[model samples]
Target: MSMPRSIGSGPAPRHGSIARSSFSASYLSQSPIAQESIARDLAEYSDDEIEQPESDSEESGSEDESDASTVRPNAPQHSMASSYRRPSFVAFGGTRPAITPHGAEGTFLTKKEKKQARDEERSLLRDNHLAPPKHPEPSRRNTLSRIYKKVFSTKTPKTESDLEDPPEALFSAEPSESSTLLSNGPPESKRSRREREDREWEAAVASGKIKTTWQREAKTLMTNASPLVITFVLQYSLTVASIFTVGHLGTLELGAVSLASMTANISGYAIYQGLATSLDTLCAQAYGSGRKHLVGLQFQRMVYFLWALTIPIGIFWLLAEKILELIVPERESARLAGLYLRILLLGAPGYSAFEAGKRFMQAQGLFSSCTYVLLIAAPLNAFMNWLFVWQFKWGFVGAPIAVAITDTLLPILLFLYVRFVDGRQCWNGFTKKAFRNWGPMIRLALPGLLMVEAEFLAFEILTLASSYISTTHLAAQSVLGTVTALTFQIPFPISIAASTRVANLIGATLSGAAKTSAKVAFIVACGVGLFNVALLFFLRSYIPRLFTTDPEVIRLVSTVLPICAAFQLFDALAANCNGLLRGLGYQEFGGWVNLFCYYVVAMPISLGTAFGLGWQLEGLWTGPAIALGLVAAAEGWFLTTANWEKAVEDARERNSNG
Candidate 1:
């Protein structure tokens, strides 16, 4: 499968990124009155002690009378129950006058006399109402219900009085004081509200008020994964439109379009995508650091950088026909494929801009911007392909023209969204500062480029290698690759959801809950894999007909498809395992593992088996299958034995440093 687009899903729980709040600690330290109240309350009651009754019962009337008799008769009578005792002032570093024997003014008090003095003092204090009322502790069920209602409820508070205390206050070390302090704050900003919600969520999880059960995790994963499925599938359809429209022309057109796409992806689009990924970190960090203008700066730097890189990319596409002829055995196919690339070059800059712009919107937490853009662009792209390629009688070359128009349209729509709707604050107009920051961007961009290129190259290699075998094999490889990639759209999104969920849990320091989420993800992956396996296996004979009418190509695809079907489970498992690693903040490890498996293990096995063993197209797939299996096994074992607590610690360290 091609590298999945890292589309932001909008304020989804992020691991290690939640702002750590010191509000409670700061409040206690700054407010001496609050601290004194808390200390006095703690000193007054043991954990096991029940609250004193508000009034004396008939059964305790005799005891109350005896206690009252011990008090000085000349002293004023108070209305408070006689059973209650005032807390000793010494507990919080204060002094109270000692009580003497009732009739002896100068004599020291006995223990019984001291008790009576304390009760009398409590009565006086209650009459003056100095102590706060003690509220009953909420049951677990009530706490969970309240938290869920606050988080998921649709109702907005109509007035200031309707606004409730922040949930984090409920579980604070000193709930009463915490509530008072939190409620007294000024209206929160958007950032502060988000941070408050995050803290509240973490507090709930930590206190076991929100149970991260497998059922809930699965439901959550599906809820998050659904929209992404639509977004990715729509974005991918942009390229697929070209192939689908051109494939119906002839076997030569089919093979040529496939070869052109492969070349364009490897040489141009992948470079744009990979390099653009650096903005994922840069723009987000800039926006997060409260330098809103820096978001625009980073975005400007990336767009300029990508545009600069396009100079060489344009040159490469211009000369690609000659270069392709040197590599591809079929001269006609090579010439046509190169022609496709040359024409596709018109869209190159626009495509790159869109890649950068998508990240630009994502940084501001507008993930749906591109998806909305695609909702229009994708359909328009398909219509243009049909209109230009077949209806306009422009033939094979018309496919690239339609693609170029669609590609150019993408950034325009995204730009409009930012300008009129939202995400406008980040852009403070272009400045020279964007041009000055090359080193950090390039340093970050290279790793992203490598990570993206590694996977794209591994998959595209099969198409390139197929050209050496036969034109028929090349056409079949195209169909196989497309089908596999389409099926991948489902689980890939699930993996993303899984990653976000696991990361959020880990960030909350709920390692055990994170593990439960991981398990649910794995189970979901297996289910998706089985469904795909059944779909592909059952549709193998008919599937190729969608791409080409060539009999040999169709036959070859049908024959080799079972092999692809057999590996679906591995593909799903491997994808989710990588996601789990990303959640654990071990994405670098995943990148290295993918490189090693795809290049070191899968490539040799594929080349050797396809040619040396004469397994042909089936052998080409065998390497990826085995590599995916190994990847799944290796990563799965690591996760099973992994130190989740350490992962949480690592997340904390990253958050602190970032």
Candidate 2:
């Protein structure tokens, strides 16, 4: 099973905010998966292997043999040092060297005499061309090679032995003791090895050989979060590229593209992402249960489901021009925005597939796959915008075309990676099972959809509400939203890192360590919140100018900046709280909290303050700030009282049932 299964089995809970970050860079640096990988590698070395002294063991062969006999029945029967030696290193290739009669009969010898006997024995072997070759080949095919062959190779095995062994065997080397034993018996399976390692880890943790501390957790969180920050920034740049390229055309083009993107996000992209989140639970549980093929099955199910929903999405985009004209007063801008969405429809399936694929990879603990994909896609997207918009002189239409192409390219690249490089083991080819399991996936998907859509629509409502006040207020809203979203990119990734870390601890049944991780997450969140608050407060006057040159928009943004800054701590805390909930498998609770806070509380206050009280943009900001505080407070309280032990039980139940 992949490392992510340890986190929990729920719809991969996404925190709802105006502009949520979707990048999951869970494999880099000191991420839980990376740490787990390190632990797995270290498991190969036994304590004796690491600490045993060669000189002491060599001087006391009888004692060493007795110790080996105690460890394993076969241990004293095989001496790896005596059985295997490099043929090229031995002297006297074809002659038998003389040996002492007492040494041959195993009489005790002094250290000098023993060395001389060993040298003579080696010379005899070398003389007879009998010295062992290095790196003896295994007798049977490795597990991965067998799986790959069964899945991809057309030739069928004629017998059981044919499946067990490779087509050709190289016998140019002498076998080590372990290899010799393996040749005599069946090779250990990966599942058995993993189970053994897990038992070892649990034993160590239970015995207090492993301990969690603030400094260690803090360092792990930071190390994991740093790469995610870069990944999120790069992915967000995909949207920014369109804005930057189109802005040069004129204000109208810029506004139209912005409007189009917002429309597409709410109407199309968000739905795909929300639905795809169900895989977080389904795939994770399946993987944890050692049914790896279910990861691909869950992925296929989400992709098909998202694709099915695209019919309505396509119809909406097709008529978006008329729809936008009814609500937006600027006909030309609305027309251009509708045109953009219509063109963007071409890439919707690809975008949906990419979202599902991201979750599939995440379930396999291949977090850096998407990051690596974006590293190429993001820069290529920018160049596409420039090439199509200016170089090819397609003007307004060129931007959407560029975006569509980039979106389509994303899943293709991910597919190539899965097909050839990694993540293939989880896929056992397409099956009809994907078409059967619709009920459970949809059940898990709906709450995630509502949670994401509610918060997304609430923020979009604020933007729409600003339009009613005046175009100047609307422009200021854009600048303010961008500033807040930029700051959000940092804390959101930190929350993801925390969520996975806590989840891993819980899965391991380490409630005490999980709590320690939660505390570290909260402290880190507070620090990040304060840093963002200070940044916005100190630079409020200048930050707006970077987005716009208009004096009115600048002044409005600067005046309202402090209000946004005030909630920075709340926003950060709320994000982390939601993450902790996800780790605890109570993400549904966070969804309900966000849905209620943003709509039931935040909306009315924002609308009433802006319209009823006539405080304008500042009044509009009032509602979300209060909502963020409530979200942070409510989720924080839930986490404090949460049953982490119960969460561990739930994870175990899910894995067992799967």
Candidate 3:
């Protein structure tokens, strides 16, 4: 054994003298895995063992030699004592040790013996130890080979316990099949990787090895929702554009159009939208369960049911003048609002039919045609409003007429698309079975309608209450409401997408996926809400100027807009959760939640804070904010923790019974 001079300054150990060896820092630094292994081995050898070199024991060495002689009886010269000596740690400048045969000592060796001794010492040093070999180590280069093997080799994990992947990476682009995939196999494209991940995910879920990641679920929801959101913005702009066009007519026309729009929203539009959601559940489940054609029939049934319900609604609109006279202060404005209402009433059936068609298309994942149809209808609606109201000089009546024509055109467009181009597999040309399912349609629709109606009526009540305070406050509230409505379009599409996706997954008996969809929907809605808050916070002072430059109205709007901005998060979450309920077929429960949160909790707070506490418009806005918070909290908790297995069963039953 040999040691370096003072580890740096002293002479090397004389040959045949005991010495210790330490690895070079440069060698250890070259390979982290080697360094780690060496460090671990060093730790295993305690301080007392490494620091204290044992003295030569003649008794033990003699006994080992005697045992070796007994084993090799004919060769008593084969002494184990020779093998008991510590190896040398010679640097490049130091003399190498001589290899001696058994019982040979105090003598120099031949060239072959010295070479063998040097090789043995090198092997021991490569292992960072000076002890003699226990059995035998392979060549020193083998250690380096192992390190390189670890560095470059890609091996599939043998067991679930061996897998250290994060949830995000569970669906990552890695090839887990084999290490030889790159060399001995075909090249894997991105699409193939994604498909492999999909198969793996389904297997994992089935075996309960892993649940779907919320991030992956959100990505799925966003992938499905993005185009739908664009479509919604385009479709909703039809109404906004109508308002913009009519605003150029006169202040009276502006107020009349605003009132008529709000009335139509609460009375007819919201109900129709809610009722159409029934198809979201039925169609999505049917499509997912592989009964694709049933979705089309369900869409037809929804349209028929909604159109029949619109008859009495039209009669109610015919008496809109008298109804407006009771609530509205000005008789002339009331008379004009009535006329606007009657014209808008002609679009009610069309609106309902469009909603049904939209949900049907969305359920089957045929979003492109719906978007293309709305893409044309939205701009056409705007053009007609411009032509009929401004160019034609038809004034207030022309706005409603243009809106009616646009609304009527949507269903015809969607119907033509389904009949001639898309959804032919599901359409089957309308069936008698659809007419017979009136009872089931009503059962499913009423709860959804009530759920939407409760929330809609709550806002409408606030609008009506604002009118009592002052017409100026009413107008300011309307401007703020419009801004909120536009921002709301962001989450509205997310809810619809989430609902459809969840229902689809549930129908396929993928309960875990359904739950993931709900979770992702809630999370994305919150993110969008935060964005809305930031956007509106920056624009609060300037947004009012878009609708009007009147300082008084602007000042009032500026005061209330911040409060509205603050509620955007809760509003987004609550709205998306409601969508979750619709997809889970818990529309009845959602109706109760809205009824309690808005009517019982929010309405009183609003009326009391505004009139009793004299906070006025801000107070009125504050109540809805509080209600939205409560609803978001309640619904978020339920959706996050609800029994997704039961949701799947319920979806199956709903589709089965229908």
Candidate 4:
């Protein structure tokens, strides 16, 4: 073995000039007298003479020598810091030497020992590294960082060498590993290893080894979607509470209430909800373009148009008893349903106003507000229903009355919040500008209304067809419909989210991003639909027991529930694709698609199979499932082939005109 340079004796190597493993502390500590003699002799040399290390041929020869030799003129003195450890050197042209930071002593440490040392050092330096402490104790920022590290930290320990240089310096000053590997002559002529690390990082992102944009979008969507989904679910639960309360009254009461609620949903609520959705396209684009006032104007117009339609709709509800009697010979049930309809009509204007408010709030990205309000109102609705029906003894009349009170309160509360609390900038107190030329607004509103109502009316026709089988069949069908409605709530938010997001992107003229949003929405909706299908299939036999205990009703529900489960994927696809079309100003296309699929295709097949062919209830649902499948296919094709650039142009024009 060659003798190492005597410590504090001969002239030393400069900082980072020599390899870490080149010297031994134990060997130098052996002869203090000899080190002193060499140190006194080396004091004559200048820093420049001892700055650069010799090549490996010279270094290897020095290691082999048994006796001390004359120090090279180019060797630099190591006077930087006694405690500092230099970074490990890269093997530019040959195999890397073993790293030993404390001369030869550093090689003795196991991986665990090295890790423990690093951790201890990190803890000691943590509070002093960033901003200086204000007091003797750790600052809140430092304390929070410690807590965060404890919660989210990985097991790996980082060495001081890794933290010594800033990333920008390392990346900019060095060359890639590939260049060094390929160089057959002098490796130092090419780039350094640090640059290679930067290149690898960029490549990793490009290859998806480390996700960037898509991951960011996924997290953004999840954060925005969770509350919206919860809001839809909680709102739907109010309907469930009403059904549960009224279903216990008796079979006739249950059937009557179910028929009444379904009629209101199909005829009144469905049509109005559809009409109000035109605001989703207009308001979302408006908000995206920073035209906040336009969102309020669109909302006002929707309220105006919807409230006007309700007057004509209220006349239809007045004749609902006769309409019900014509469809089914159950005169007693029809009379009861008409009575329920008349009471519910009191809340129609409130419902219209609330729908408009929700779209307005949703457009401006105030997603959590809707959920917060619904959370309070949903429970209140349930309590009020219990109070009026059971405590006040108003019978079936109480359910609609309770619903009307809450329905009216919902819009009032939303308006108060928007007008005074958070949405003041958008509202501007409802303008008369909303009452201008109604031609364009009417044209946009009609298509969306027709699209949703066509599908809803088709299902109602199936319910009417169920009446042809028997009233018991109708009652059983109602139970099945409730279960399906509950499952439908799962994907409904994805639809709303898709439309709002796409419209915003379109308004911003981000066609690529808008297309990506559509694709992601479809994927998320489909996944949620499939998950619900699995859950429904798992609980199909048992869920009917929650609604009714009658063997016939339970048996009928158990039979049809699986079909409902099968229909969910297609239903989700159809709904989300319709939302995409609405965002693209293609609601008219969706309306025509719905008209053909539901009325022309689904209705005929449903009626013929149930009544003409005598296939009963099973045949009734087969039509809708098949029709939804066709609708999904058609809409998916349209969305995939859509010209997103044109969508942006159309959105701008619509918002400007509105």
Q: Give Cα-based local distance difference scores for all models.
A: 0.61, 0.60, 0.56, 0.55
Q: State the weakest 10-residue window (summed lDDT) of model 3.
A: 1-10
Tens digits of per-residue lDDT, candidate 1, 1-658, equal 1212222211101000000101000001112222232234334445653232222233443222332212122221111111111110000000000000000001111224334334433322222222222333355557788888566532323334223533223434233444533566554443333233334433444444433455556667888788877776786676567778787888888888878877776787667766776665565445433446666777888889989999999999898889999999999998998898888889878878887887677555566777788889889988999999989999999998998888788899989999899888778787766666477677766755654455456677777898889988888877787778777767766776777667656654557767988999999999999998999999999998998888898899999999999988988888788768766766556656766777799889999999999999999999988888888898888888888888776655543332
Please write out the lDDT profile of model 4 over residues 1-658, one tens digit for every residue. 0001101100011000111111111111112222232233234335643322223244344211211111111211110011111111110011000110111111111122223222322222222222112234444557788877555442224447435843333333233454444445455421233223324333322332221133334444565456645654576666666666676565566677767865775677656655665554455444433435555767787788889999988998888999988877788889988998888889889877876776677554454455566767889988988898899998778888888787788788877777676766567465566766455556655654554444345566666677667766777776776667666555654564566455444543446656777777878888988987897788988887776667777788788888878988887787677667755657557657866877688778888888788879888888878888998999889888877777666644533332
True lDDT of residue 586, candidate 1: 65
Clashing pairs in 1: none
lDDT of 3 by residue, 1-658 (tens): 0000011000011111011111100001022222232233334445653322122234333222221111111111111111111111111111100110011011111122223323432232222222222444456657778886455432222345423434324433334554324656777643343234335434443544433445456666777678755754675566566667665554455566656655765667656755665554455444433445555667777788888889988987888889988997866666877899899888777767876776676554454666677778878988998898778888778888988887788789988897788667656565566666466566655655654454456566776787677656766766766677677667755765676556445543457656766767877888999999998888989887766556777788899999989998987887687667656656456557766877788889999999999999999988878988988898778877778777656544533332
For model 2, where is the 10-residue window of minimal lDDT? 96-105
Best by lDDT: 1
Tens digit of per-residue lDDT, candidate 2, span 443-475: 766755654455346566776677667656766
Give the lDDT ranking, best first: 1, 2, 3, 4
What's the candidate order when arranged by decreasing TM-score?
1, 2, 3, 4
User: Candidate 3 lDDT (Cα, whole model)?
Assistant: 0.56
**TM per candidate:** 0.72, 0.66, 0.61, 0.60
Best by TM-score: 1
By TM-score, the better pick of 1 and 3 is: 1
lDDT of 4: 0.55
